[model samples]
Target: MKADPQAQRRLLDLQAIDTALAQLAHRRRTLPEHAELDTLARELSALEDERVRAQVAVDDLDRDIARLERDIDQVRARKDKDQDRLTAGSGPARELEALQHELASLTRRQTELEDAELELMEQRETAQAALDQVTGRIDSTRQRRAEVEQTRERTLAEIASEEQFKTSARAPLANDLPADLVALYDKIRENSGGLAAALLRAGRCGGCRLELSATERGRIKAADPAEVVRCEDCRRIMVRTAESGL
Candidate 1:
């Protein structure tokens, strides 16, 4: 392919811009915040599960404590009623003796119920502590996630702005070039990892960093100024300058 000598030189500028754009895209994809968010998401999910389990345990203990309190209250009420009847002394001796025995039994039952209630209250306290700890961890994880997301958004915005600038600069330069030359560059770039041209400096193929053999140098030296030369090794356009040592 043939392109004006100056137009070919401009290809280098276009390549630099394109390379910068590619680097920006890579940075965007591999931002540290992205990985951090993923890790935090997993941690938050696990913490949420733990919080659910803790809350369920706390709720179950609450129900048990409430039930025990009701039982203790009923037992105390029965004991009170029995004491009141005995104090009245309105029944026969046999009946009064039975009432006294029944009051003793009711007292024992009340004590047992109160003891059980106390144990349940302790368990509820422990369960509540566990739930609080889990909830605290959840809040912390969510806060971290929000911070990371903010950082990620800021980084993306910066990348996008830089990309826009590079893109704007590239359009006019690319548009001014010969259509065939730009088409060729695009094709090579697509296949060569975004590198379509390189300077031939110090008798070396800049794209591959390989020295040109004597015969290859001689051929390129004989070629016309407007001729597009591709490196034998890397197949990229070799843009020659005074420093090329051709």
Candidate 2:
């Protein structure tokens, strides 16, 4: 491509901006906050599962307690009826003996019911403790997530503003350059991780920081102004200017 020297330099500026933008994008993706948020999300999910299980345990214990209470009531009623019959003294020996046996069975059933109720109470207490812990963990995780989100939002906003500034800086170059040159620059940028062009500073390719030979520097200095030159070491478009000090 045969572009004016100044126009080609402007392309180099555009390339610099693109490089910065790419670096910023990479930083955003690899930020520590991103990984922290992911970790917190996993913990939150686990806490929610524990909370659900605790709730189910509590509900099951409640049902068990209720059933035990009903059983105790039925046993007490039977015992009361048999005691009344024994006190009436209108029954034979066999009948009285049967009443005594019924009373013993009822007493044993009541004892068993009371034991089950105590066991359920203990289980309920344990479940409540677990639920509290799980709830606390959830709240903690949510707070951390909110903090991470705020940081992410601030970082994203900063990156956007920086990108906007770069675009503004690049606007002046776009009008003077041809479409084909710009397309090539964009293509190189994509493949080079946004470092499409680099200055030949101090006889070295600034992008790769590789020093050039005496012959290579002389050749580049003697090249026609309209010719596009790439560095032999890094294959980046070489911009030779006063900044290059070559």
Candidate 3:
């Protein structure tokens, strides 16, 4: 594809814009906040699971305590009735003695039940503290996520604006160049690592930085100035400049 010598130079400007656009796209994908947010989200899920387990632990303890309390109430009521029967003095000696012994047993059983309830209450307290800690951590993480999301959005907006600016900057240059040349460059760049044109500086292909042979230099020198020249090794469209040493 032949183009004016000046148009070949414009390809450099287009490449610079294209390179910036590519860098911007990469920056968008690799934003640090996105990774951090994802990590926090996973941690929050784990915390939620811990909280549920802790809650279940607390619930079980509560049920145990309630059963113990009911047992204590029944024992106390039985002891009261037996004590009243002993005081009434209507039973035989053996029956009264048996009633006294039963009352003693009931007292001991109540103490045991009360001790068990107390132990379980302590366990519940500890479990509740753990639950609070997990919930607090979850809340803290969610707060941080909100903050990071805002920052990420701000970063995205800045990138979007910069992309718009670069796109606007590239529009006229791309529009001013020959359609066929731009199309060819686009097609090649798709498979050429976003670099379709290379400056032939110091008898070297700027894309690959390999020096051209004397024969290659001779051919380029003999070619028409308007004819498109390509690098022998890199296959990039070569553009000559004052510093190109062509």
Candidate 4:
């Protein structure tokens, strides 16, 4: 492909813009906030699981306490009925003595049930505290995640603006070059590593950092100034300048 000597030099400028755009894209993908958000998401998931377990424990304790209270009420009611019968003196002496013994047993049973209920209540309190703690941690982690998301969004917006600016700058510069030259550069860039045109400095291919063979350098030296030269090793357009040392 043939392009003006000056147009070939300006190709380097286009390459610089393309390189900057590529770097910005990489920066956008590698923003630190993305990793932080991922960490926060995992933390929240684990905390939510812990919270569910704690809630289940509290609920189980609640059911146990309710059942124990019912048992205690029934025992108290039975003891009350027996005491009333003894006070009324409505039974034989033996029967009254048996009623007294039964009353004693009911009293012991009530005490035991009351003690068990107390222990269950304590357990419930502990379980409730644990549930609250896990819930609080989840809320904190969610808040942190929101903050990180905001940071990530802000960074993305900044990168987008930079990209827009670079793209706008690239349009006119690329338009100014010959269409065939730009097409050739684009085709090579697609196959290469986003670097189609590079300076031939100190008799080296800047794209591959390889020195040109003596014959290759001689050919380029003899070629017309407007001729588009490609690196033999890497097939990148070699733009010559005074620093090329050709």
Candidate 5:
């Protein structure tokens, strides 16, 4: 397409800006902070689940201890009443003998309750330890999460500022170029992984880094200024200048 050389050069500048912007966007997406945040989030979730389970275990042990205490109390009270009856002379020998036997059974029952209480205490302590560990992990994860968030925000802001600068820099070229040409440039940029225009620098194509033959350079120089020329190596639109050393 016929376009002023200056306008074409401006287009190249716009292309370069857009290419840099794309790289910035890709970097932002692949930032380590993003992965770090994800890892922190997963760790936090697992810690929360573990904490909850530990708390539940502690609660269950508490209930079990309470129930065992109540049982022991009831059994001891019954044994005390039986002993009182036997000592008060209010029962026959057989009845007193039965009361003593009941008291011995109550003692065994109390021992069992005590053992259960001990086990429950141990379980409670273990649960508490697990809870503490999980809480510590949660705190650490939260701190890391905050750090990741801050880093992500900062990086995003920098990228935004850079993109804004590139957008403003491309503004001057937008008015002079036709919409169809701009679309074509954008398509080529997408297909070329963000490089749409390349400078013919030092007799070489900047995009492909391949030297242009003398005959090819002569033909490129002889072409009309309005004519757009492509590099033989990469097929990218080539913008020539004195720096090209053709």
Candidate 6:
């Protein structure tokens, strides 16, 4: 394919910009924030599960404590009502003796209920403390996740901005080249790992980093300036310049 020598040199600039873009893409994939965010996400999921479970436990304990308190209150109410009846003295001696005996049993029952209520209250407190811990961890982890996500977003935006600039810069250079040549370059870039052209510097293919043979160098030296040349080893467009020693 025929291309002006100056236009051919611009292929190197295109290659440079493309290389920068590729590097930026790779950088986006390998950002430390990505891994950190992944880790944070996993941690947040586990913490959320734990927080939910702990909250359920705390709720269960609260219900138990409430039930125990109600039972103790009922027992106290029964005892109080019996004491009122005893004070009224509305019964004979035999009935009064029976009432006194029943009052003693009610007092014991109230003590037992109070003991059970205390145990439930202690359990509720413990469960509530555990729930608080899990909730705190969840909050902190969510905050960290947000921060890492923000950092990842900023990094991606920076890379995207640079890529846009390079793409815009490449537009006119690509437009100046022959359409067929640009098409060939694009195809080669796809097939050759994003490299369609390389500098033939100091009797070498910069793409493959392989030295040119003396006969190959002489052939390229004598070739027409407008004739497109390719690296023999890698088949990349070999662009000549003052530094190319061609």
Give the distance in Å from residue 239's predicted Cα in candidate 2 to where it truly belongs. 1.4
Best model number under lDDT: 4
Candidate 3 versus truth, CA RMSD in Å, comes to 1.7
Q: TM-score per candidate, in order?
A: 0.96, 0.86, 0.93, 0.94, 0.88, 0.91
Residue pairs whose backbone atoms clash in candidate 2: none
Best by TM-score: 1
lDDT of 2 by residue, 86-184 (tens): 889787999899888889988988998899899889989998888888888889889989999999889989988998888887777765688787877
* lDDT digits (tens) for residues 203-227 of candidate 4: 9999999999999999999999999
Candidate 3 overall lDDT versus native: 0.92
Q: Which ten residues in a row have the lowest lDDT in candidate 6?
A: 61-70
Candidate 1 TM-score over all chains jointly: 0.96
Pairs that collide in candidate 4 are none
The positional error of residue 168 in candidate 6, measured at the CA in angstroms, is 1.8
User: All predictions: root-mean-square deviation over Cα?
Assistant: 1.3, 2.4, 1.7, 1.5, 2.3, 1.9
lDDT of 5 at 178: 74
lDDT of each: 0.93, 0.82, 0.92, 0.95, 0.84, 0.88
lDDT of 6 by residue, 21-132 (tens): 8998999989999899889888988988898889898888788878877887887888788889899988898988888999999889888878887887888788889899
List model 3 lDDT by residue over 135-246, tens digit each. Answer: 8998999999999999999999999999999999999999999999899888878878999888889988888899999999999988898888988887789998877787
Candidate 5 segments exceeding 4 Å error: 177-183
Q: For residues 1-246, could you state the per-residue lDDT of candidate 1 as single tens digits?
A: 888999999999999999999999999999999999999999999999999999999888888888888888888888788888899999899999999999888888888888888888888889889999989999999999999999999999999999999999999999999999999999999999999999999999989999999999999999999999999999999999998898
TM-score of 6: 0.91
lDDT of 6: 0.88
